[model samples]
Target: MSTADTTQSAVVAKLSGLDRFLPVWIAAAMVVGLLAGRWVPGLEGALNAVAIDGISLPIALGLLVMMYPVLAKVRYDRLDTVTGDRKLLLSSLVLNWLFGPALMFALAWLLLPDLPEYRTGLIIVGLARCIAMVVIWNDLACGDREAAAVLVALNSVFQVIMFGALGWFYLSVLPGWLGLPQTDLAVSGWQITANVLVFLGIPLVAGYLTRRLGERAKGRDWYEARFLPKIGPVALYGLLFTIVILFALQGEQITSRPLDVVRIALPLLAYFAIMWAVSYAVGKAAGLNYARTTTLAFTAAGNNFELAIAVAIATFGAASGQALAGVVGPLIEVPVLVALVYVSLALRRRFTASTTEAS
Candidate 1:
């Protein structure tokens, strides 16, 4: 390898350890957000004041900044290989769509039947897969960056297409299995498409363009060394502030319905545990390496809360129980995934030892 390749590898190695703590910081931000929401209700309106053309500027900016590096790293040419890993892809698809959702629905019903609003919220949270944050987790787990990029891209597309269908199925079809009333869950496809385009699509294009331009002017090594790291913290802090605002806006609901938060936690925790195990097992059975397995496991476990939250607000009002359920997803997800990263590292070492001994 060239000196630049060696340096970049070293940087990625150092970053692997630091990346594990990001979720902790994100969790801490959520707590701070809740406290801020409770203590200072006025900040919500102040945050709203800085809106841009009807969208929350801070939230939009946060998502854009957070997604830049993620999109930049995507190797579009490798997407073809996704079909080559048909077994892995099929396993993920079934787990994400069929098994994962069924388990979440059952758990939500078992845990929050009395609270229909929260039940709907949990369903919404479960139907969506991770779009933004999973990229970071995949990197930390030393996952297959190419497969991850392809999955991320594919999941984004699937989310837009399957969201309303899966959502309707959850609200209408699944509830009947549990003897719950069939309610029509309304979601505006156009509005959701718009939000996805603005928040996710635009940033993704911008990141791709920026990376391409930078490579032409300065070289890939220069871009990686000088530009990427500088923007890393901006994305982190942007997400932090957005969480603060979200909590601030929903502070009253959170405070009034404290028990409801606990109610949502059980199903979410169960969903993560079950899905993580299933993904890991499937990856191993498919003969994937540790890196790709970690990617698959995390991709299955994480929820795309940004889309869920936006849909919750659009479908059920900003302070609706559904929206709150979406918010609670990340609150639980961040910490659990962080712990799982450590678990993944342990598994990697064990697998390596076994392989070496066998060799």
Candidate 2:
């Protein structure tokens, strides 16, 4: 068998039940949520009844559950190693922070100019960088695992620091400067910070502490091989749970406005394609090996949708269009990124052949 074929089989072997059919699970969750919201009496009211300072308690729990396991998987100790690689580090920062967000902003406006709520939501999605699933994509495509880990950690720190400021700029300030219509989000930087703190901060700190303690007590092998597998599935469960609740809250809007869902999806589809393609080209030009190039591409292309969804629902109510836009994010991202994984592997074979010829 070709090396690519072997790698593909290995990836398939590694996929857990939750990870293998994530798109299917997400679709099912959306359907279940829509049905419950539409048919079940008082389901929406019951979900909305318990709020933690205007955020639904059930949703908040789901967000925390989704975020914790993924963050906990990050290798916080390896940051120094990746940071020392200036080319990889700088290229990643530029692609993720600068190029990724700007591209999404342009796409959101260019595509959904009339739909302000969904537009704002897409822009918000842009600012939230990837911290979770890039690891899986990277591994599946035979990318650099350590690079993915360190990069995810870097993105997490930047996420805490930069998300609110960027949100304010993209949503409020930048539009006014450019004569585009401003978002009606009505949120301050501090409010965004507070919401991020409650949603992202709590889980981030918890994940870090869990990793630190787990490694110290049981050693890295046990923590990774034994403990991580135990907690790993929780992230998907939490994601599906959150999606169900989100759709349940906004089912009427989503089911009724199918076209709007398509509208929200276009920019997302464009964003992933452009970001991955550009990052891959850049990685190749910068003299990266195929593995590191793949790592850079996936990391650059992916967004922290979990964070995006949490921020959207927190700032705008669960039923808001902004939240709906966020909900549609994973629905599009899961399938698209999965396709990119195959693309990356196919390119890997060509990449290997060319390198072999050159050497």
Candidate 3:
């Protein structure tokens, strides 16, 4: 076999059982939740009744569980390496913070002019950015792992700081200025801030502390190789658990308004495709090699669906259209990004060919 084929097989082999079939698992969860919600009596009310300070306890737990391990996997101590690459750092910041949110705002507004809840949700999804799954996608595509870790850490910081302000601006202020119909998300700006603090803030701190303390006690090798693998699967468990609950709560709405789900999906599909292609092109034009270019593309394209879903459910409700929109994010993202991984791999070979010819 060719060297490229062998490398490809190895990379694909690294995808754990859960990661490889993520879409299928998520779909199964959705189906189970939907069936339970549709057929079983009083399930929604039971789920709703168990809330801690208005946020669903199950969902809050799921959000934390879904986020913490991923954050722990970030190589926080090595951030300076990525920071030194000004071209890559500046490009990533621009693509993630500036261009990504703006593009989603435009697409959400353009595509879902009449559906304010889904639009707001999409905007929230955009603002959340990718702090978790981009690492996996980057690795699958042979992107620079250290770059992905640093970028994910960078995104986590921005998400906590900017999510609420950006949420208020896009959901309330921007629409008013544009003379567009604004959504009464029924939550104040401060409430959004509080939710961001509780959900993203808590997990970020916990993850950082876990990494620092673990590495200090047991060394980096033990922390990453031994400790991280043990907790890695928990994130998937939490993700699936959250998805089931979300779909169950919103089952009636989802089943009733299937078209709205499709409507919600269109903007997301476009956002991922456009953001990735543009970010990849930007990375290449800026003279990044294939790995860093791929890293930039995945990091720029992915969203923090866990954060978005938590925020949507916390700010709105578990059964809100906004929450449903958040749920749809990973459904669309998993398959699309999995496809993009192969696309990145194909382009990697092309990149190599071009470099060889140039030399």
TM-score of each: 0.86, 0.79, 0.78
Best model per TM-score: 1
lDDT for predicted candidate 1 compared with the true structure: 0.76
Q: What is candidate 2's lDDT per residue for 61-91, written digit by digit as tens?
A: 9878977887787677876776787899899
List of clashing residue pairs for candidate 2 = 129-304
- Which ranges in model 2 have alpha carbons more than 4 Å from their true place? 131-149, 156-179, 182-185, 198-200, 289-292, 304-323, 342-359
Cα-based lDDT at residue 90, candidate 2: 90
Q: Please, what are the lDDT tens digits per residue for candidate 3 over residues 1-359? A: 75555655676688798877776887898789888878889988888788754556777787778777877776677767777999998999999999999999999999988888888888888888886667657865778867876776677677667776777788888889999877554434554445556556677789789989998899999998899899988888887887788668667767777888899999999999999999999999999999999999999999877668767887787677788898788868977987898789778766776676688
Rank the candidate models, highest lDDT first: 2, 3, 1
**Could you arrange the candidates by TM-score from highest to lowest?**
1, 2, 3
Model 3 misplacement above 4 A:
52-54, 114-121, 132-149, 164-227, 289-291, 305-327, 345-359
Q: Residue 259: error of model 3 in Å?
A: 1.8
**The 10-residue segment with the lowest total lDDT in model 2:** 184-193
Best by lDDT: 2
Q: lDDT scores for all predictions? A: 0.76, 0.81, 0.80
